[model samples]
Target: MLLSGQSHAATESRLFLDGKELSLPEKVEIENLDGNVMIPIRVVVENLGFKVTWNQKSQSVKIEQRDKVVQLVVNDLMATVDGKQESLNAAPLLRKGSVVVPIRFVSEQMGMEVDWNNVDKVVSLITPVIEPTIKEPVKVPPTTGSGTSSPTTAPVVEPSVMLSQVNTIQFSENQLKISLSASVQPKISRLTGPDRIVLDLPNTMFSDSFRASQGLDNKLNGRLEVSGYPDVSGVRYSLFSSSPSTVRVVIDLNSAKKYTLLTETTDSTLITVQLREEDSVNIDPIVPNVPAVNDGRKKVVIDAGHGGSDPGATSISKKMEKDFTLAVALKVEQLLLQEPAIELIMTRNSDVYPTLQDRVDLANNMNADVFVSIHADSFSPTANGSQTFYYQRTNSKAFANVIHKYLIKATGFKDRGVTENGFFVIKKTKMPAVLLEVGFLSNSDNEALLFTEELQNKVAQGIVNGIKEYLGIK
Candidate 1:
């Protein structure tokens, strides 16, 4: 056998920075910090409730939160928290005339761990390390042949590749499943070690070409590593099959190495890894170790802002912002039902008040993809229109902007655009978070329009469109 050669390339993955999500194709590179790891004095301090200011003439970075001022010299590599010298990862690098400090150290100082995984390459700042199970195994099928090799197969027959006998491959909807059959059946066994469990298919000298790829759909983290299996191409996926157990590792090929990633399904959903080459695998699927979000469902967290007698802002006719948020949210529930890909959730579906912290807690528990808080803005009686707000710390500004732009256009309301606000729900949700000030209840024009079913449909349609765009839907 001259070995008919072909290979599958993995898709791309990404992370976020400065409200901008960076798409890293193959590897996530974390540069070693040369400076002392003082809090960035920018990202960390400001995120931790400190006020921030930029001095152009002095080239200084200043922060004030809770009656304390933090000052830092841009090039001097020095700063003071309440007037004290502190270390820095990089001297405040000047960029666009503002002091820019390294992201890792700064986020770390804010009591968070700045992590950049090299395999999938996503920069995540978490309060603690979530040790998601990593599956790494080696399986061997019962082999009795001329002591040579044979071909592999897929459960669904692929007409493109012509091989003698390709073993059947199936995924277990219940427990992990595996099987093997060949003229020369190879030994299939389970292997386990610290933090990994995988199937080892023996006598398979895998031949492959490692090709670098980028994030496929902002969900998958593809990495290529050469393990013994020909099915594994590019960065190998270390799947977690619960330490050591009997699992199937079938090598079916014409010329492709790939891994299938299955996420919870819904309407308006995108299955990115399917039909793509196996060279890419979801190396670091955010395995929810937290029981709160580990139910394995594509979760959503909806927030209704300014509640609990807080009533937020009010209008002359006495249409409370809280009441309207609840009403529209209930309407949104009806609209979202049209698409099964999404699950509808709300901080307050009823008139009951939910604290900002409670909203954040609910969202975190849900492991939300998009955290949306509905509210009515009250700036001035004349200020009428719809707007959206997001936290500058939790990077999702692009997504926020997308929704905000279309919402204003679709609603024909005043355009307040997208903004970064320190609302509690936006500040703490663990996923792509945004808060929509759907309209100005204080504005007589909008307050009257808010109750109309036509306006509700427009807002729902706009929100649905925004979600489709983010998911790269046509």
Candidate 2:
């Protein structure tokens, strides 16, 4: 059994089981509420050779070891220890997907002694040792032809290696070098939405010297900021898991780029990540051209947020935010096309990804009058509303306020109001720009409403109305 202090206090406090220090998993922290030291129930109970189970229907937790069993309900001050009712100073609660309980109560009930050092703010759990019974080994009879039996031997195992250091260099290519005590193959993968390349090193741990060099204490993660590199932004490393001991290194990228792993030999201890701009390929390009009609029509650029490899936010029904944004943008385009006083330009017309820079360049080159980027918000499931965002510019705020009025009316959801934010599309564009968070994808009601064609048409009309009102057109 082991006990840890509260989340705020746990940063400086140390946790010890017997005499050895333990490292808590990332995002799992002990919390103290009132006077009780709360700990994640699964972390402490499961490590003490106990089986922990949860009942989803009843919202309760059960822990069993041999004939002893303990049960706890969420937000209930009473618990059951072997069919006998027991009172608790504080009830168990859930935080960040883990159930936390009073550490002292759980530790004592599980037949362990808990000690808290006030001076050092250290938590220690002492378990009683059970002696194993010894039995005499049976001797085998000697072989008929052999005088002595062959001596038995145990196989020797090699110690696991550790990652020693990480460094970056920028020359013709952005290079990331990882040093290790021994050679190991790294598993590589890619992620989008602020693109990144991930490298996973198996059976490795961070060395003490490397931890000290990176200013990492018991926390198993650190980041290094890289400057003067175009494609590469920063490098992050962490102890991803403990049972199999996997270390993960993520290379943050400003955009999608091509990379290669360089090593001298199969057993080389140095792994180099060579990053370079992806080879340019010709595709359908957006032509920055003004309308030839010479009529004094205001040019508006409609941007759909994320597409292609980037799905943006996933809705409650698992629908992609890109799909919703594109759908709404197309409807807005249809509405604006019928108007004689408006000229429309779309950042993306299909299921394609236009980088933030690409969108900004197109708007700037064409000299648009107003820019509106369509996107659906995402957060907790309970977060559902309509809002608009603008950068710090005065004209942008006026643009956002006008658009938000009609947007809230169209969505008919909660009015979250207009706010100021430095969104890339809105901030970089020279014209009056506003990014509309039409509704939340995480909310079931909003997701269903957004998929309806009637609502899409209404929202498109509202956006056009807002634009016309801002431009002083009837």
RMSD of each candidate relative to the true structure: 26.9, 24.5
Task: Compose the digit string of candidate 1's lDDT tens values, residues 268-359.
Answer: 11111211222233322332323234443345566666556666556648878777777667766676666556666778877677666677
Q: Global CA lDDT of candidate 1, please? A: 0.48
Compute the lDDT of residue 343 as modeled in candidate 2. Answer: 83
Candidate 2 pairs with clashing backbones: 6-32
Most lDDT-accurate candidate: 2
Candidate 2 positional error at 348, Å: 1.3
TM-score of every model versus the real structure? 0.38, 0.43
Quality of model 2 by C-alpha lDDT: 0.70
State the displacement of the C-alpha of residue 404, model 1, in Å, after optimal TM-score superposition.
Answer: 0.9
